[model samples]
Target chain A: MSIEVNNIHRIKPIASYIVVKVLEETKTTSRGILLPNSKESPQKGEIISVGPGKKSESGQLKEIDLKQGQVVVFGEYAGTLIAQDESSKYLLIKEEDVYGTYE
Target chain B: MSIEVNNIHRIKPIASYIVVKVLEETKTTSRGILLPNSKESPQKGEIISVGPGKKSESGQLKEIDLKQGQVVVFGEYAGTLIAQDESSKYLLIKEEDVYGTYE
Candidate 1:
């Protein structure tokens, strides 16, 4: 299942945590029939929400480098699985767990 | 083997990393023989060195709360094993891996 990048989310993460919606891949047959791959979840996703930042030892807030709506790739087993609804699954992960951004 | 807290270390860590010397327990037999327990390595250790701190996304350097000569406890499989010399083994780990400090 996937969510629109512009959709509003009710959950807010704290301290460098990010809310991500996992992107699912859709395959197509020669006849243009769509086949949903349910065996595995992709590591790529869109950032739905971002935290303010992690506090330094000196009590300074360091802002995260990422912004909402950006697509990013994370580690295979990086985040905790969370469900926003019965059909929508989100991932809560640290900004450091993001491997890179997709252009 | 354990190292003296006052001894100076030649290696320095970078980016919120910490260098720790694992403490070894020594037992005595009824006949007054000193026996070194070599079966398992303790998770407790003395902080030999610490990094400045992890850089914030804004490029600010935070200070670590720990200092040299302080005893700290880490996870059972938290750090990477490194050797300063033939008899001295040290663990290189992130500051976050430290569970607590011994007062």
Candidate 2:
């Protein structure tokens, strides 16, 4: 279990959510949550990876269908969660803390 | 000492920067820093505020000039800083963590 690749890849996690890492058990969401900063993260998880968006300014890249493992609900005050690992359940929210994406 | 206006003013905080409230005394330079989450917040403060645009998809609103009190550098992981105030400085980042705007 080793994965940490980077080629200066870190838009800093605002490329737009689609980050899943639960593997199983799912049910206890407040929806995408990430709001905290004083020096680098304050909490993390809840918005399981998401892509298909962000780059819109005419640079044209606007396309969100919420796929990459789906299961969202963000906006407890959304955006700002980083826990790339710890089996704590990978997280890094944005895309407006998702707030709407569920089955 | 009371200020908190809103018309559902909570895209969570991703409508694009421009939010000042320092009083007087600047120069810490960490740029626009924000990140962390698990519940609601993890830390907060540092991104005085800035905005000029962000609303594309042909709805046309792409302009990002970073004003309203410019002094940025967002990207300590880019975006997520909420403090509102308490002489605490007022934080709420997510303009791509601003990472470039200083003078």
Candidate 3:
């Protein structure tokens, strides 16, 4: 199945790649001070769609351990920016790039 | 079996990784002028040992396509430098990092 983000782009990840909806953090600090965007922090995103896993050397399609809607963390530089619109941005990353899932 | 380089380091690759013996290019030009080492060129190496292949999602070990003594090419920056001695240097690289084999 394909994931429709912002009801605009229908994306279907392939081969162990996953589509993530970047979860933007609150731009303001606890003291109500606006903070500039930082690239050093680990990126947090919600898995929109997971691919059918990568193929093994024997040509078998292995299943990925992740699922859609899981909030996952990844490196700041990981994944490729796929789509960016007014409201949200999307990234396409390999399953291995995902560090782990969080609450 | 482990591969020995310079009769000093015995390396055995693990899980889709391969030990490569870097083949140093000729330092002299056509006119016998010594050229400085360049990192822009693709590195050439001979496969010293191949890993048993990465395990699939089912935990089955797939077989690597390469074999020992085969000359392969890879990106200049690919792989990790595992060992270096007086006569030869060694690198540990994944099978996927190998571009292809040549005579």
Candidate 4:
């Protein structure tokens, strides 16, 4: 694993949780208007690390399907935001909180 | 199933989604301070209906452990709120968005 990947695991998310690095969104819209950072919009991020799945009714571990490096879309305010560093932040979201994945 | 249960099925939630009826929280705290409806706090709700689980990486449908009538705790602003009727409303959340279930 690279240094960036290793840094993500410093804080391990538990129980079907995933750590994602929010990707930088496009600053300009199709109309060439620059979107402000304060704009409210759905977010996309790349999975950095994932926890073991939550237990099922029968005590089996239900696996999360998302893999590391996969980009996923989530609602505008779905998960808890954690500041990993002055220059970066990460989101802690359950696997199912992800609405969809980018192909 | 009772009529209420049947009524909940009118809208079938899909893909690990669940329909939850927000419960009436305690109006007064243990110290007897009245809590206003506008006060923000984590929410608790009973599962009205649950959709089939999301698909796994292997293409199999994963299973959700929550059952009908089960009360679950969720974040303060976790899911989309849907009005079911004039006096009733429901929330649509993915199974993993549920933090815990009351036994």
Candidate 5:
């Protein structure tokens, strides 16, 4: 693992959960207007740590398809938010909460 | 397919989407207090129509694991809401938006 991952391992996700470092909220709209604390559902973030995949009916561990370092979009209120500090915040979401990943 | 499914076919989902019929909102809380228009996410609904599947990176169709008639929990604002009529309302959400299914 890399140093960045090591840093993120402080709060490892369990089960089918993943830790996501929230991106800086866009303060300005496309029209150049300021908007604070947008309530949009689909928010983007970078994946930190992924947990072991959920068990199947037959007790098989199906691995998650997502990878760490990938930027993904999910429902804003989908997961439990953890504020590491005053400036940094992370979200612990299930793998299924992720809608799509961006390149 | 059953008659119920045929009726739901009028609004067949495409791609990785699924049609969910919103359950009646609980008018009262456990304390018998009225709460209307709750803003919480992860609401429960019954699955109606499901899409064929989503195209993978290799352009293969990946079928959704959910089945019809299953009630699912999802972020309230995760999907586009469509009012079928005065009383019936549905949501069009991607397969990944579903958090879990209840028996």
Candidate 6:
């Protein structure tokens, strides 16, 4: 608790929220094509902590939602950039911001 | 338009929906991980086309749900696999399947 309380990189996620670290950066082409070949394989991020789940329109809890330690893909256009531990981070994107979770 | 109208990879997406082509594959390591050293740069996908946005519970349309030609990242656990033009593809992931769109 003390460790995370001090480390910005380490955060205590609220219910219905997720903690993810950027793992890769992708390179895009002039026509908005991401060259299959980037400078290298893009970085990968890990889901550290997770919020419980989102409420559905009918007011019931949504499904499993996001989980801790799951590798996720996100819409680059979504999310707001924030600085944590003096490093750039993003947060609170809608569940839609999450794409795939690799196994 | 004509090209997409014919080619399966070349799809005509509806407004508010998107058509994406997978460009890379991500490989995760043990302990719930993505090696980052995938066989190659993970395949990239292009938003070939899109569909009309989903309506909100209030009946208004949602934000730019998804667009054509936007390279996207998705959730490993989300989306149903479908075959278009007899090739493997994914679809209608509730707009939540999209992650980042590189610039």
The C-alpha TM-scores of every prediction are 0.41, 0.31, 0.44, 0.45, 0.48, 0.39
Per-residue lDDT for B12-64 in model 6, tens only? 23224454556545465456676665333333466655545544433355566
Per-candidate clashes come to 0, 41, 0, 0, 0, 45
Instruction: Say which candidate scores most in TM-score.
Output: 5
For model 6, the stretches where C-alpha displacement exceeds 4 angstroms are: A1-6, A9-11, A26-44, A85-90, B1-103
Residue B52 lDDT (model 3): 67
What local lDDT does model 1 show for residue B40? 41
| Winner on TM-score (1 vs 2) | 1
* TM-score per candidate for chain A alone: 0.71, 0.27, 0.76, 0.74, 0.76, 0.57
lDDT of 1 at B16: 72
Q: Model 1: what TM-score for its first chain? A: 0.71
Give Cα distance to truth, residue A11, candidate 6, Å: 4.1
Each candidate's lDDT (Cα)? 0.66, 0.42, 0.68, 0.67, 0.66, 0.47
Candidate 5 lDDT by residue in tens digits, B1-103: 0112223455545457787888866757889987665556467889877767765434456999988899988876677543233445556688888889978
If the candidates were sorted by their TM-score against the true structure, best first, what order would they fall in?
Answer: 5, 4, 3, 1, 6, 2
What is the alpha-carbon lDDT of model 6 when measured against the actual structure?
Answer: 0.47
- State the displacement of the C-alpha of residue A88, model 4, in Å, after optimal TM-score superposition: 1.8
Error of 3 at A96 (Å): 1.0
Residue lDDT tens for model 4, B1-103: 0112224445456568787998867758889987775866678898988877776544468888989999999877776543333345466677878889987
Better of 1 and 3 by lDDT: 3
Residue B61 lDDT in candidate 2: 72
Compose the digit string of candidate 5's lDDT tens values, residues A6-102. Answer: 3666876776799998875453433343332323434667898899776756666666667799876566568886645556667789876765554
Q: Judged by lDDT relative to the true structure, which candidate is superior, 3 or 4? A: 3
lDDT of 1 by residue, B62-82 (tens): 888999999998776666543
Summarize candidate 3's per-residue lDDT along B33-80 as a digit string, tens digits.
876666455689998788667667666678899999999988777765
Regions of candidate 3 where Cα sits further than 4 Å from its true position: A1-9, A26-40, B1-103
Compared with the true structure, what per-residue lDDT tens digits does model 6 show for residues A32-62? 4433331112223467666655555776554
Which digits, one per residue and each the tens of the lDDT, describe model 2 over residues B1-103?
3335332133234457545333332222123222232333222223444555677756677655445554443333333333344444444565655423333
Specify the poorest-scoring 10-residue window by lDDT in model 6 chain A: A35-44
